[model samples]
Target chain A: MIPDDALVTATWDDLIERDGQALALSGNDVSLLSELATAAVLFCAEGDATVSAIAAHLEELFGAPEGADTSAAVREVLTTLQNRGVVSITG
Target chain B: MPWESGTAFRVLIVDAGNQGRSAVGERLLRRHLALNGIPADVIRVTSAGLNADDGLRMDVGAAAQVERLGGNAHGFRTRSVSAAMVEAATMLICGTWWEREELCIRYPRARGRAFTLSEIAHLYEELAVAAPIFDHPRLLDSRLRSSEVPDDFDLPPWEEFEERIVAVCDAIDEATRWIAEIWASMVPHHPQPKADGEEAAEPTCTLDAFGVAVAITCGGSAHEALSIAGKRAWGRCVVEDREAEADLTIVVDPDPDVLADARLTGALAYQDVDTALHHLSSAVTVRAIEARVGQLIMMHAAGLAGPDGSVVGFVAPSGTGKTTLSRTLGAHYGYVTDETLAVAPDLTVLPYAKPLSVIDALTHVKEQWGADSLDLAPLPDAPLRLTRLVILDRRENGPSTPVLTRLGHLEGIAMLAEQLSYLSKIPGQLHALSDLVDAVGGLSLLTYRDVKTVLPLMPVLLAGSRR
Candidate 1:
């Protein structure tokens, strides 16, 4: 779970900016835990909405799907994200 | 010495006095060898005459050698040995240089004959550079005249002599190309020994860019495949051939001086292998990933591109009508890439609507678009460019609607950064990424349920094109 707030997006070669000016990020910008967690999040929360929305809409989306364990997948992603500090709650 | 007489090789060491840097270079070479599963005894050639801590180390064995004498192969000089000799030796060991006049000529009887030809041309070129006398023999001093040649033939017209000089240069170039081909062939060449007996142990390269798992396999042709994958992933790869079971092997020689070293041996093909890896990992693949992530971050969480630079991009996330809509649009635009879109810095989403990789052939994208209609060509050579970006969202039993939202600078840049794979500790990455987002016009395009619903909005995105 890349920090929704901390995550800064840009084009392939675009310079990062803060307050209309270019900003610099060093080696400290990356968190190993977050990168791994983000993978989990993408795999889990990819179908229809954001990570938070997936957590809320889990039953509605995957409850009826044959052989679906939406809750477990969401929990796995949440645990990974929570451990990495990208998410606030585990449930 | 006679045992290895036919074996020609060269040792090049530049600025070897720089102990720390040289040591680093040596370690890099060793690591490269191990990564590529090259079997050769590592022999460091540090003579007693030179300082032990600060002398050069040369790897020698049954396998070939490509070592950098100095930083630059073309211009390094040694007190005991000539640069030309070292370069020749390297070429021989690497087994890349060969005859040019006879294209199919394999290893000739002479060890350093190919490089000698190069040197001969170089000498002539050097003379021509110093004085245009070769081109204009009339300018030659009488003292420099060769007695072996008749005076009438010795001093020809400037144009005629210039033509002769050009021909020599062409010959040299032709030889270089021939040698390059021989060397390049070694990269993928292997002796097919009936595919019997013990299969050679698979050489594996495990490169962890931070945590990005890059597993490179080296075998008969797996090394090539691994290289291709690494190139796609924007990771470094190298191949070192043992010249035995593995005629061509990819090794991760991360030594900064490997290029310089390979030059010493005249291993043009080996050098080219590294050069190709460098180009793929650093330049092309990195740019592709950046573009993919950029489209994600800056635009309305949508992938867009016009195949053949014509139609609009059908932007949508996974499970959205994006793929279904893309298939329809691909018919018109020619499908640049299916999964990703290359949004250039100038605010154009280059379509990558290549062959739709349909897991379930029965899906709407595969069914309506039909397998034949999709462009299945690989992305590298595929045709497409961005004319418009149409974001998609599925609405069951509802008409497809197109809505555009302005994606500003920071927001857009943030979105694109999500897909950056090569975020190594490079200084320029942050700034370069930001600049890219600003250059591309970012927007969020909303899509309705039906794939065809997004068709009308294609012309609208094209209108923003400054192209």
Candidate 2:
């Protein structure tokens, strides 16, 4: 299951309203989060899963583009979210 | 009794030979000051060469370049740079560092008064940071001159030389305005006497870029504080009285409870003026001002003007390094407003020239530093058209190198909307922002940590909208 702390509980507007405009994310970040949120919701439904399993699920659902490394992209996105305090990973 | 009453601020431009460098510098300086609205009667400009023979005309190429820049080249006879000439001049500007040094060596007393054109620009920048309130020209005349005399860089060909002259003229124009603004602020304004028993007019308060106006009802200390802040932010727009009409009215409340409460009532406020001011941050004041002017379509952005009178706006939320980047790039591009960039219906940027809010070390309060205090060139007098927008994405430990990705119209609007001061108040805010995005074509998302990495990309970002 996804940790409560890992999830960005507040919506974009909610965050902006609470912390003022500076906390508002860029459009690209919001889009990236939307994609990640979808994966996150599905991952939570599956309970605890490995990073590879999550990446595989994303690849299967979205389909990896030609010459694109879906696993690395998923890891990078997850790492970015984690760095931004939007997500947390547990063993 | 007086030899000459009200002699103008005389500037003598000197070169090794007056035919070329001195003539060009003189013409540029004179034309620049005149173009920028500094009256000719207020500042007299002349040129002379140290080693020049009497009656030698300006160099053919330099004279043509001066003519091209709309400056007079006729009757430009080269006079020799004498001790008497040096003594007469209030300010002596040299075409080259060597010329300045030679003049200093010949006339030791002229050392403090004489400076190379580039040296004066550098000194102005330095003095702005160190002692912003001092009369720059007078201070520059009295201060100890630099001993270093570097050789002049090779001048470009005649065709390209005109471009350099234009650049020099622009620099002078900016510097002259900066000095005038600072000096003007230091001089206390004396209201003119009423003519023929006319009634005293009600005091009117004009708001600055952030749309903040302080009423005359406030205490003396509060008035003083607000006046300084207002002058720094809006120049001479901060007016007295007008409590009824002002966007924000600050009144000193003597009542203990009211003092403790710090109550805000619509556009009015009751607070312990001294205590409130002591604790109040510029950011909070700006936010309050934004709330007051939220009815108007304004954005929290730093505005800069390019050479072509085009404005590039960097819109971002507070603490996003908008001010930092604006200060860094303002020398190259004229600084408009760092706190609030108000846009007209046609998207022309109104000149704000507000003092920058610098974070105080101990209190961490954002103290207002006058625009002239910063080493930034002044904005040109003409209206600036909005040519570009950049949504800043500065974060700690982010990428070392800045990456600027272009945003689509809708995306640009979305990003810009978040930075809009009074988005909800404006009826068609989104559409207005969308129209601006469409007109400007698109915006760039500037993501980076250090300002240095992003500094080089500013010209590219400014030019990107034109494409």
Candidate 3:
């Protein structure tokens, strides 16, 4: 199962409430989060998955098609959210 | 050579020297191109003087004249025409016939390419008369390629300089139709064009071209939408940065699950990027950004600057007729920003020439329009300084003329505080505002019904501020 501390339940709720509302984001951040959202959805589906497992899944789905570094992108997003205290990182 | 590549078309305006007629022509030509929906990156415009003292700034009078005609007169510096400039020019427009002859003599290769402004205008007119249906750029190309050099008209008197500039601009405007057509033809078509009514799949966002840098954190699709919105609203201020050290950080968390939880704290969160954008738009995002920037910097009242670099800020709440007065005063004065006037601690005004937002009658929604689109004059190339603050107390059927009364700094700050963006956020905001009041020296109470009634009092108001 996903770590209890790992899920950003409260922040996610607030974000959903504010959706379709007037909020602004930089173009880059928007793209980054969108990428993360796709990966996060997949990660959550597995019920119990490590960050490495999620990164590997993302690589398989997006890496070759987009010629992107999925691992770095995933790490960055997770770290950013963790730093902001929006999500707790539990190994 | 650049034009030959089919990627970009370069037009060089040649004059006797830089900073005078040709400089003005360059600005006018660029304005006409922009008005016609021609992007600057595609068709590059530059000016050069035959005998220019390179690096000299454009003449203030000429710059002001360009501004009056709704063309930007900022960032202009004189430069002598060079062989490279002549060689690169797909079309060489001379300010006068004399300049054309000089170009032909100095650079023989430019002979077939060079044409006086009037000559180009005449050619455009002749082409239009002949075919009538042909586009502007094709006709322009036909004229430029032709061996014939049309004769020039007699130069107008010095006193009729403004009139002459207007006439030249009119001619250029006539020619730009084809210029735009040619530019459109050259644009590379996207491999996969978006279907009608289809929302962009990916999020693309840029900083407002005319506004401050905003760090946007949102999903992909939202980013793309913001990019489109930013272009439409902010012009060229959009930037790309994953890590933005911005004045304001806008966090967009559009996940329904994330937003449903009540435990969210810290950054402002949105349900999705679209909702966040919607909120920002309705909230007047540009104003919000400006207000936020003011917290970091110094914020002043909205207004225009005179030729002497002195700004006249109109302080009033929304729906109090500030826009109407700004529009009216803009015609006669150097048009500064209509919404927020951002100043350095030194009191120098920064140019935030965002499109003026006017309320649409049918939808009752505020629509943004470029300064050129509204026929508003551009701000002159001068260091803008805050000189006067006018507190607008617009009353219907109250007075036939505007009554001007001076207010103490305390009253001015109190009045100004209401209109200030993010006043509470700025550290030492009161002291900064007080310093600004001292620098400009008090405020004027402009009580009036109609803008026309206040027109005659502008000079008096400006003069009174100097005392």
Candidate 4:
């Protein structure tokens, strides 16, 4: 579930890149996110990124696959990041 | 991480008298270090004996042999062996088999390293054939540890009885050259080709700080300053070679196209080695902290661990007397760091023994000093753990006696999150942090007017009391 206010996130540069995967670190927690998932977390790390904005950006970057609902897809990505404490969805 | 040789290749040769076989070996090994472009000041080659006459001149034969080998033994003096000599020696070479046996029996710690001169020559011959020795820089220092002592190592054998007055003297001379060759092959000279009438460039030193391996190379004043810095500040972290891929390269006035493959490079352009060192300190610290991004949960705190490896992390923001308190606490407990204290998920504390950046009262500039320089206690041999967390609250006229009040999970987590680095990289970090707080019996806010006030509470806090 994505929240309303700002996303508390670390920069892309801070992510630990290993074996073709980027690991987002938060103290004791180390979350290995997929390329698509990493993109959503980084895009939201800009502080004011909304769910709709992230979906549109991802759709434009990777291209929406034949009228796919990317807004729903983006929500799932953000929810995973939220669950991992990679980013906080604060209202 | 593999163990790094923090100290220089300190070779201490022993015999019946320091003047003869041991003296010859010392002079030759010094030549070896010099030819390999390793500064004599950075590396140590000295001799001592169990039954030695202190302040005696080098043996007449040994002195003549040293000169014959193109080395001056004018200043060579004999001294009886001390425990400190045996303890500090990276390689303990004995002229006789009996010396090795006696040396080990007296100093049990040196048992791993104690070797006969003949034994070393034989090991070098065996190791030289095994080309993989080049890949293992520390194996030369550690082969004694891994390999068992030969069964007949205690049996005395003389190579040349009729030729030399002392039976072992001939073998010592022959074996000394071999020892030098082994050192030369291990630490090859710097790539800078010697120009006409110019000496070869000094060798590079690998430093291990906060789990980061940094290789430093430079010439002139920079090299001189770094040599002193390497010994004083990062003495315990200096290794023989770049065994692991270096995390960062600290080069001063480096030739372009040199060290191109390094992951991170901090190059010093100017020849001002003194000023460059101040900047170098900053670079090492920044890179060291960055290297632990995924592995360590680092806090911008000062850590002091008890003798039992129980670490009490004094979590505070910069300029909150963390550094000041560290000096006081360090005298009592093992000082980990005054800057960043990184911990594993299992609560194990990783040592970041960075030079303490202390502010000079008169100069008002932060001077970087090794933990030893400040008379701080060294980290205990035991494995360190984050047993307690103290959120320091320092204010004028706060309390004469420190107050340790527990904070609830919500406030504690928020405060803790502020002091942490790269939180987004960790999965389930917040809950883990909350669990850590609970495990430590809740984060305690220590309100005190003076640094001394907080000292009394360490015993209570480390005891893990709920109050």
lDDT of 2 by residue, B1-467 (tens): 01122556677888888887678777766665544334455567888989999898888877877777667788889998886888677678787777888898887546556777666655544433211111234345432332242234334556886677655445544544444333221211112234588763333244444334533223323455554544454453344443333233333455634422322221122234323332222323343333344244566678888776788888866445778888888877888877567777677666666666677899865566656677687766666888888888887877999888887555566567645643534545455556677677678888898887877876776674677
Which ten-residue region of model 2 chain B has the weakest summed lDDT?
B183-192
Is model 2 an incorrect, acceptable, medium or high docking prediction?
incorrect
TM-score of the second chain, cand. 4: 0.52
**Clash count list over all predictions:** 52, 2, 44, 12
**How would you encode candidate 1's per-residue C-alpha lDDT over A32-76 as one tens digit per residue?**
223333433343333324444554454453353357555456656
Q: Which residue ranges in model 4 land beyond 4 Å of their true spot?
A: A1-91, B1-203, B240-242, B245-266, B269-274, B465-467
Q: Quick one: best lDDT, which candidate?
A: 4
* Share of the reference A-B contacts seen in candidate 1: 0.32
- lDDT for position B243 in model 3: 32
Task: Residues B316-356, candidate 3: write the lDDT tens digits.
Answer: 55445666777788788776766556666776666665556
Quote the positional error of residue B294 for candidate 2 in Å: 8.7
Give the whole-model CA lDDT for all candidates, comma-separated: 0.33, 0.56, 0.55, 0.63
Cα error, candidate 3, residue B245 (Å): 3.8
Candidate 3 Cα misplacement greater than 4 A, ranges: A1-91, B1-205, B208-211, B215-230, B236-244, B247-300, B424-429, B460-467
lDDT string for model 2 (A34-91, tens) is 4444564346434655666776677777788468777667766665544333344664
Instruction: Give every collision pair in model 2.
Output: B232-B355, B233-B354
What tens-digit string does per-residue lDDT give for candidate 4 at B338-451? 767778888888776766656689987656677788888988889988888889888887989888888755566666765665554444565566667777878878889999
Model 4, residue B391: C-alpha shift (Å): 1.5
Docking quality (DockQ) of candidate 3: 0.01
Better-scoring candidate (TM-score), 1 or 2: 2
